[model samples]
Target: MWHGDRNGHGEGGGRGSAQGWCALALLHGKIEAHLERELQGAHGLSVREYSLLDVLSRQNSGEGGHLRMGEVAEAVVLSQSATTRLVTRLEDRGLLSRYLCATDRRGIYTDVTRAGLELLERARPTNDAALSEALDAAEGRPELASLVAVVRAL
Candidate 1:
């Protein structure tokens, strides 16, 4: 059996290590699925879309506040091509817009539109609630309780 270590690292990079990784993946997947279902049902937004919107909404016109496409990809944990497609999808829905950077003509920055911001504002609570519910449920599971505790501690 794969018992977790006190430090949450599992035992010395052995079977416990693999089990720890699997447990972490399970925790993440469950939480993401819960968030997805809630966000989609309540706000017509996928987890990725909501995350992108949330990331973009934090941008400011002040220097270095606006993120380039690459930076956005990093922030949202998507590949550059995937991020571009996501941006395009949001743009089609009038949720986001892109413009060339004033300081660097070769650079492009994306911004969440008013519609996107409004939707994000509404979906934020749903996201938070779903995350909380998922973590609470996971905390009840032996395999996931430690991971959930770690996440909560973080």
Candidate 2:
């Protein structure tokens, strides 16, 4: 538990949750940067675009099976407007499609197009490989080794 010390440090022997949070943030940044470089170079897609495609591709066509813009935003960790813009960009690239919900005309659902699925399939390996490479590199660091192990366990 965090002691909530004045310097944001823990009072116990440990550095506390703040330090853990920083470590997690650092690991995330490293992994994201590695994935971004690999995905962008090999697939001509940004990390966000690839993530959007991956998220949308998992939706079912059955009743209430698709994600709304708000849900997509939550999944992608983006704002609602930002998710809409990302959807528009992918739609323009023929990677995604948006349509009105059958039961609720006011609701719009987004799905991955064939092109998006193909691209996602192609990029999946790259993303996985880059993530492994990042974790491997981070594992060598004393500060990140435990986090890397936790991630691998997960």
Candidate 2 Cα deviation (angstroms), residue 152: 1.3
* lDDT by residue (tens digit), candidate 1, 1-154: 7765676654566677788989999999999999999999999999999999999999988878999999999999999999999999999999999999887999999999999999999999999999999999999999999888889999
Clashes of each: 0, 0
TM-score of 1: 0.91
* Every model's TM-score: 0.91, 0.91
Clashes of 2: 0
Q: Give the TM-score of candidate 2.
A: 0.91
For model 2, how does the per-residue alpha-carbon lDDT over 50-126 read when each residue is reduced to its tens digit? 89998898889887679999999999999999999999999999999889988889999988988989999999999
RMSD of each: 5.0, 2.3
